[model samples]
Target: MKIVPSSVQLLLERLRATYTAEEARLRLSRQAERAPERTLRSAREASSANISSLWRQLGAAGVEIAGVEQELADQRTLEQAERYSGNIEAMVGTVKLPVGVVGPLLVNGLNAKGLYYAPMATTEAALVASYARGAMVATRSGGVTTALLNEGVLRTPGFKFSGLIDAGLFVEWVARNADELKAAAEATTRHGKLIALEPIIDNDIVFLLCRYTTGDASGQNMVTIATDALCAKIEQDCPVKPLHWFIEANFSGDKKASYIGLITGRGRKVSASTVIPEALVEKHLHVSIDRMLAYGEMANLGALLSGQMGAQGHYANGLAAFYIATGQDAACVSESAVGFTRMERREDGLFVSVTLPNILVGSVGGGTGMPSQSAALSLLGLKGAGHGAALAEVTAALCLCGEISIMAAIAAGHFSSAHEKLARKR
Candidate 1:
């Protein structure tokens, strides 16, 4: 979506509280006069000496410097337009499964740059309204748009390296006895491929990690089956003695118990810790940094990691809705949800930002090609691979906006004003 020019004007209104037409026009003129290129230069030039000055400019102009960085990154994403042609994209794949509770419907503005959400599925219907109110709250607090902003993606490859086998013997076996091995593996109705990977040890077993793009599905199971078939072939072929016969899959390392030896147990509760800047608390722009730090100390940031809350919260309600509307493995949200939200004093106000590293989101292939998902993709004006990352960047921005809005309300003691009319009547 196009960035609105009125966004800056709205922020000025919040800061000035009230403004004449002339004042509004002047603010707009100042922002307009600052070229996008200059904004980039200022961000790049942010130094200890002039950092305060640069921050004041951003605060007064209602420009988020970090958001600009995300935008620049998005504009440079690898797409067909970038002319990166490789079979790797075609080789990697994904799979989806059903698991866990589907909690809460969230909402955010269409033009929003980040994520916003409410807890409890019962509260889902009100999510959109809450964010809209939140948007207004932010606008009044020198904020401009109510939308979330995200602009990038992260992809985790589906394969890992394994130990080596006797390359000379393995090659000889493949060449001399290909027909026999193929016939035996076919007995079990297994489809497989033979590829010689780089060696590991001094020849214990021919270790091959099967890697392939499973074509619009989570390929974990398919890879496992194929690997098992190849293992059986190795056992039969040119074997001096197959010692150290072990299988590792699911991309987890040898540290985890083997699937055969694994004993399932009840899941454990999660706990985590994080640091928050103290200056934001002093500005009444946030809860006591101590409180957030305490929460982290007590529990892992799982709930906060999802939906629109906490630092690094992005993925506008639209993105989640889009994920659901499409056939994506929404539970993948678990890994994709990990990120950081940071607040620091900049000039007289606060500068807020978020960073998400393991946002294992995908765009093309898999459910993205489904009919419903295709329609949702159309709605966001997205096509091909990098849309998921773009959605994520927008989601993170919205999440930061929500936290900032709530923090401002609590600090100003106006957090409960939304229900004031009913409270007064009672």
Candidate 2:
């Protein structure tokens, strides 16, 4: 479609004074017409002929707009590509847990006293056994608790910025100096939400990650612009220099992190009498359980895992389509797909868990307001109050479960026949 005509532009300029970016895009397009220029020319003519014809039309209309319409078409083409890139994640299979592991699960399921959801139910199985065992080893010495901290969502105005800033102060300033932040936000034609997190862990560097919830369509552009602005501000205000900054992590561009999402918790305690026999470890788990135990290795030592290795689950492709059809900030999925699994040996048994910090899931706002996403959320029974943190926890659990299942099968030498067998006609 052609850009709005000058007369239409005058009308829209007045209306746009109050329009949001999304609204403006729609209004402008609605008022525009596809002036698909055609010219009588020999087949040998160059492609530039289309541009020349479009320029002639605008020139006759007394509009002084720059560039031929083809250029505008090219610009939009690039933008469209950028918008989907973040949502289009790579596909790696799901990883499974080791074989024959068993244990108790102690999730530090506490909260700010009055919050509604905190239940630590135990799911007994080979997988749960391994997780509980690992937890015991990690906490054998004592004080091995898992805490759930949530850095919730923040809304962004329809504006764009280009700079760095301390996210803590930036958000605080947004709160204390609402007038100024609002003014800045109102100045741009773009805006989105930003989510920041600071790990409660100590000794190690603080983890500052952010997720920008771009409303409707892909939010890649909006997030990039907003973060650039925020980062610029932080660089100017904060005293401590940031070691690194990224727009996307884990895979979904929507999920970014200051550092890698890691597993950090005390190893559980395991009693010698309760420990899985060393022979069983090598035979079933395929790992040297005896050596790990003797190395004075905290039986509950933490494990660093890789991406999905066995199961075929959600990939970047499905997520992108899901985001598009649902109206989510598709790019956030980049950071959301960094799936991982962790294992630690516990006195009672080995602990196995999965962690995916890049899970950019939501049930309200934008796409959640759409019919399809709402239906999907309802199907999962997550419609009412679950937010970002709950999704992250669940995704992490899924990864860990996969790990436990995979490892168990591998140790038992059953993974191939159980999950990976491809049947053929006899």
Candidate 3:
């Protein structure tokens, strides 16, 4: 006897068919063309004298420049400062941050393995030391296990139509011509690949959620340029013209925290877990396994009551410091900090794990080329290509260390005292 498929099963089959069809078309039309060259006018050398010249130019333009020149330009240095042209505009002196090391953190991950000394650049006192203590405990307990679950960067572009019929027709056309759009997007960058194009329709509006896998780089600007090219192609070819459209509809959750980022993820989705022996927890954290677990439950409740996106403690402390030290987009911490922390009881010990859905980090590109940031990445042995996943894994593990330490401190009733001793003066 033959059995009929259920509604859910049929829906799954249809979705699989749609994906396979798009993949087949992409494979067939994989030839990518080079993007058009765009250049900006070169700024003068990034030297103090050149800065003074610019200040003179600004002064001539009747802009008040004496204070800025005295404070920022006077403090500027010439050590490879010329390279700052691409990274900054209207050059001012760099603000120096004290960099601290938290490791020999042992990470057993798919990409990241062995011991690493993670560099954290921040002004916050006791942050690095707390992470260091947690790292020590984790290493003694056989290290943290990390996994890079998924990776995708999204860029959503919206379109306006006269009515629902036009919007539906546009969505159908986009779905049918996904391959061409993918090709156009891929043409803009050698490293970025257009992995998926999802159409979300609302009445007379259609939003195309363009997702890409950016190789080795965070791919923010990469996706934007590629999507621009794809939009241009759509405008030229699609028979149904949009009444209005935009390159980015602000639906991607770029630097802001949102429910969509928590659900679907924006960058690298990574998780780290470890089991700290009960004895180790008692010795190092001065807290019993049961106490830690109980505190975690209370913390989870407080997070929910406060409307937190994901229940966790101080994921931002490690993420922000790591991002700044390793040359990632620091603002991304707003979204990257959204994650879940789980603490459960095991026969052998207390099991602690952290799952971060949005970890926008890269081993190369952007600020990674800067002198201090590059050095920090080198310190962790995570510099250059083929290390983005490893870097992300390390980041997740680092966050786990922070979570463990904070939970232990709060549970043991030492959180305030430790901070007072480390951060305040008598």
Best by lDDT: 3
Instruction: Quote the lDDT for 38 in model 1.
Output: 48
Q: Write the per-residue lDDT of candidate 2 for residues 1-426, one digit (tens) a residue.
A: 768898998987888688888987876685435564643332222233433444555666666756534444353333333232222322111111222222222223222111111112122233333333333333232212222333223222221122233434334444554344333333342434443433211222222343444332233354446545555554565444545544333222224431333221101101111234344455545656434333323222322233232122233433343344334556665544443334457764554443443345544554555433455444434453434333333323333333433455444555455432322221
Per-residue error for 302 in candidate 1, Å, reads 12
Q: What are the per-residue Cα lDDT tens digits for candidate 3 across 1-426? A: 536658877987887877787786776784646442432332555655565566776776667876766665544354466766657765656778899999899999999999999999999999998999989999999999999999999999999999999999999999999999999999889999998899999999999999889988988889999999999999999999999899999899999998878999999999999999889999999999989989999999999999999999999999999999999999999999999999999988999999998999999898898888999999999999999999999999999999999999999999999999999952
Model 3: CA > 4 A from native:
1-49, 55-76
- Top candidate by TM-score: 3
Return the TM-score for each candidate structure.
Answer: 0.36, 0.37, 0.86
State how far residue 234 of model 2 sits from its true place (Å): 13
Model 3 lDDT vs. the true structure? 0.90
2 or 3: which has the higher TM-score?
3
- RMSD of every candidate to native, in Å, equals 24.2, 20.1, 16.7
lDDT of 1 at 10: 85
Error of 3 at 307 (Å): 1.1
List clash counts for every candidate, in order.
34, 73, 0
